[model samples]
Target: MPVLLTKIEGKGNGIKTVLPNMSDVARSLSRPPTYPTKFFGCELGAQTSFDEKNDRYIVNGAHDAPKLRELLDVFIDKFVLCKACDNPETDLTITKTEEILRDCKACGERTGVDMRHKLTTFIIKNPPKNPKKSKVKKATADGATTPNGDADEDAGGDSDDELTLRIKAEAAELTADAAIAKEDWSADTSPEAVKARMKAVEASMASVSLAPAGGDDDSDEDGDSPFAHLGHWIEENREESAVEIYKKAEEFGIAKKHNTMTIIAQTLFTENVLTEIPKYAPLFAKMVTSEKHQKSLLGGLERLVGVLHPDLTPAIPKILMAFYQTDILEEEVITQWGTHVSKKYVDREISKKVRKASEPFLKWLEEADDSEEED
Candidate 1:
C-alpha cells in the first residue's frame, strides 16, 4: 500500500504520465519498476517507457491518480502478493519447466502463477536480477573444500554432481519456542554447557570486534584516484585467485563506496585470461552471482577481448568453457545475451564480434548433450 506519485510532463498533445517515485515503490515491493510499468501499458493499451537509469517511468497519454492507483491494485493482486502466504516478500522465478512461480521469501513456499496472463509474458522475458542462491560446501574424500567444484567430463567440460545438489537441499524445520525451551538451547544443561554459553554471550557482548591476525584493508577514498591506486596495489600484490581479488575489491569499499564494479573486474583477472580462467573461475562464479558484479565482469571481459585483442575471438569458446564449467553463467542467459550488441562496456561492433564468436561454443554445448543422448 505504498503511495504512487504522478507528474504530468511535456506540452499539450505530447504530454505523458510520469511516475517519479516508481523506482522507490518497486524497491519496496521487491520488483523492478519496468515490470509494473509494462503491465500498466498492456492493461491500458498505452505506450510506456521505463527509464531505469534515470529512475523515471512515463506512460503515454494523461492519467489521474485514481485511475493509476486502481491499475496498481490489480498489479499487486496478480503479481506482487504471494498466493500461498499472502505476503508481498516474494521472488518471481521462472522454473526450468518454463512455469512462472511466485516464491515467497517469508513463508518459503512456491505458488504457481497462471501463465495465460499478459503480465506473465513480460515477467518471463525479464527474469529477476537478484541472484541469492545459497552457497553449499562439499567435503572431499580426503577432507577438502570445493565451492561448487566441477566434475571432469569426456568432452572437455564439467558438470555438478546430482547427489551434492540434493544433499545440499536438506529440509528446513522452523523451531518453536516450546521446542527451543525443551532442548535448553544445547544438548546438556551441565556446568560445561553453562560455561560455554556464558563465554559465547561475553564474546557477543564485546565492545569492538578485531580483524583477523593478517587481514588487510585497501580502502582509499582520496577523491577520484582510488581505482588508480587500487590498480597499482594489485600490481604490487600477487593475488592468486579471483576470490582473493574480489575480497580486495570489497576491502577497497569500491562496490559500496564508489558504486562501481568495473575496477574490481579489471584488476581481478590476470593478463593471460584464457590460461587463468581455470584458476580464477571457481572464485569468479562466487563474485558474479550478483547482478552488478555480472555486468561488471561482462564489461571487463568486453574491454579485455574487444579492445585488447579483437583478433583473438577464437578463444571465446574456451574462455566461456570455464564459466560454464563452474555453473556461473546459464545457457539461456548467454544465448539471449548473444542476440544483443550491448554498449555497456566496449564498442557495439566489438561486442557484436565477441557474441558472434561465442556462437560455436554455445551450439557445441547443445549438440554435445544431444550427441551424448544418441550415444
Candidate 2:
C-alpha cells in the first residue's frame, strides 16, 4: 500500500502529518481507517485526530512516509499475518476467556495473539465489521462445487456407495446405542423397598441442623444470609460515609468474604452510577486488594447494570470508562470482564448484552495502552 504523507499548516497542532489515502490503505488491509491512524499515534507518542466525515487522518508532529510505512508493517505482522503459515488471510476472534485468537483460512491453523500488547484490546472491542467466513467445498461422486460456484470433474460411482454405507453404519450404531440406553432404567416400588427408603430419608433428616451450631452470636440477623444482611444494611444506611460502611462491614464479620465487594457494588449505586463512581472509587480501590476481590466487584457491577438497573445497560461503556479512569478497575480486569459472559451474576443473555455495551470503552482502553507503551 502507498503512504501519502502531507504537511498540514494552521492546524491546532502546527505542521501535522496527514495521511490522505488512509481510507484506501485500511481497505486493502481489511480494517477500519482509525486502526492504523490510532496505531501511528500510539507508536509515535503523538496525538491523533480523525475526521471521519472528511476522511482526514492526522497525527501530531511531522512524520515521513518511510517511518509510517515501517510502523504499518509492524502492525500488519502483529495483527494481520498468521503465525503458522505467515498468511494474511486470517480472522480475529475474542474468546469467552478474553483470548484474541487469529484463525488462518489458508492453513486452517488457530493461534493466539499476545495479550500483553495494547492493540489486542482495541481489536477485541472493534473486531471485524463482517468477518470473512471460510467456505467448505463438499465433494461428491458426481462433482465438487467451488467457492465461486464452479464444479469440478466427477468421481467414480463406487465412492458414493462407500460413503452411503459408512453413513448408514453410523446411523445404525446411534440407534442401537439409544435403544440400550432406554433399556438401562428400572425403579423399585415394592412395599418393603418404599418403607426402607422412607426410613433412610427420615434418618438423614434427623441428622440435619436447622440452626447455627451452639447458637452462634455472629449468625445473621433475621435469618438472612450474611451477604443479604450486608446488602440490606448498606441500603438502609445509604447516607453513611464510605469509611463508615467499610467499618460496618468489618463489624458484620463478613468483610473477608469474596462477595462482600459484590454486595457493596450492587447496594451502593443506582441509575446515577456513572456520575457516582468517582465518589466511591477510593473505597473500591482499597477494598479490591486482590484479583478475587476485583472479580467479585465486577460481579456486583454485572448485577447492578444487568439486573438492578436494566435501563442503564446502554451506558455500560461509559460506566466502565469511569471505573477505569478512577482506578476502581484495572485494564486487565476490565478486559477480562468485557470478554467473558457469565451467568454467575446475571443471565447469560444479560451478561452478553452488558459486554456488548462495553465494547467502545474496551477499545479505547486498548489504544491507550499502546500509547503508554510507546511513551
Candidate 3:
C-alpha cells in the first residue's frame, strides 16, 4: 500500500496509509491543463512521472509537445506576473484566454500603466475554471489489485511502478521550468546591456558634433555650421560648390557609402533633388541599414517618391549601368544599385535607358524578373 508523508503528533513521521482528497491536491498544483480531454480539468500535468527509459514522461510527438510547451510558457508568464503583484490580495479575476485585465491592486481602479515601469507589480487574472470535467483520478481494477489476492486501495501514485512514473514526470516539469526561468533572466538582463550601448552611442554622437567640420585646418567656419558655410560659399562660387559641400558633409558624419551613392545618383539626373539627397543622406542611409529604422525609412521613402517628378527616376537605370561597368564596384555596388532600381522602377519603363549608364542595371532587372517568374 502507498502512504502520505505528513506530520504525526507534532513530529515528521515516515509515510502513513492515509490519502488526501484529490480536490486538495488539484488546488495545490495551480497551472491549468492545455488538453481538456486528456487531463480532465485537473492540474495533474505538473506532477512528476518516471515512466520512460529517459527517466521522463514520453510526451511523444503524437501528444502535441509543441502546443503543450507554448501553453506552459504562457502559464508561467502569467504566474510570474501574478506573483510579482501579490495578486491574491486583489479580488480581480481574468476570464478568457484572449481577455487581459489590468486593474490597480491599491485602488481597484483601471489605471494607465506601462508594464516596463511596473515590472515588480503586474498581475494577470486567473483563467476561468472548467467545471464540466472531473478533477479526480478514477480508480481502476488493476490499480486496486494487491499481493496475496487482497484489495489494496491507495490514492495518488499507488503502485511502485506508478510512483516511479509520477516522479519522472515531476522531474521533467522542474527541468522545463528551470529552462524558462533562465530565458526570462537573460531577457531581463539584456535591457540593461542595451541601455549601456545606447549611452555609448550618444557619447560618440556628441563628440562628432563638437569636432571641427572640415579636413583642411585653413578653411574658415564663416560663423555657422559647415553646411551653412558651404551653402554661403556655393551662393558666391559656382564650380567649387559640389566638391566643397561633399567635403563639408563628410566631416559632419555623412558616411562614405552614402557619399558614393550620392555621386552615382547625381551623375544620371539633372534635377534640384540632388541637393535634397545630400541633406537627408544620413537619415536615409541609417534607415536603409537598421532594423529599428525600418518604420522611419518607409515613411520618408514614400514622401520622397510621392513629391519627385517622374522624369527624374528615368536616370536610375543609367546610373546602375555605370556602377556595373566599374571594376571596383563589381557586385557590392551593383547589388545596392539593383535594389535602388527595383525600389523605384517597373518592367516597361526599366528599358528606357540604352546608354553605358543604363546597360548593367537593365540586365540585372531582366534576370531578377525571370528568376521571380520561375519561382
Whole-model Cα lDDT of every candidate shown, in order: 0.56, 0.63, 0.30
lDDT measured at residue 202 in model 1 versus the true structure, 0 to 100: 26
Question: lDDT per residue, candidate 1, 235-336, as tens digits?
Answer: 444423343455566665653332233444444344456555554443444344333444455555655566544555667766665565455555545555
Tens-place lDDT digits, model 3, residues 103-198: 323222332223332221223332433221111122223453221123334444344335424433333342122221111111122446435533
What is the Å distance of residue 84 in model 3 from its true position? Answer: 58
Candidate 3 Cα misplacement greater than 4 A, ranges:
1-238, 241-246, 250-309, 327-333, 336-375
TM-score ranking from best candidate downward = 1, 2, 3
Full candidate order by lDDT, most accurate first:
2, 1, 3
Model 2 lDDT, full chain set: 0.63
Query: In order, how many clashes per candidate?
Result: 0, 0, 11
Stretches of candidate 1 off by over 4 Å are 1-225, 240-243, 256-261, 362-375
Candidate 2 per-residue lDDT, tens place, 1-375, comes to 556456555545577888899988876565678878888888898888999879999988888888898899988888778899887756576778889888664454678877887666677787654311110112322564422234534444444334324433333343122221111112244557445533432222121111222233243444445555566666655566666666678777856555677778877776778666655655564465445676777877877787666898878776765565443466667888888888766668988988887887677666555554565
* Candidate 2 to truth, TM: 0.41
CA lDDT, candidate 2, residue 216: 30
* Best candidate (score: TM-score): 1
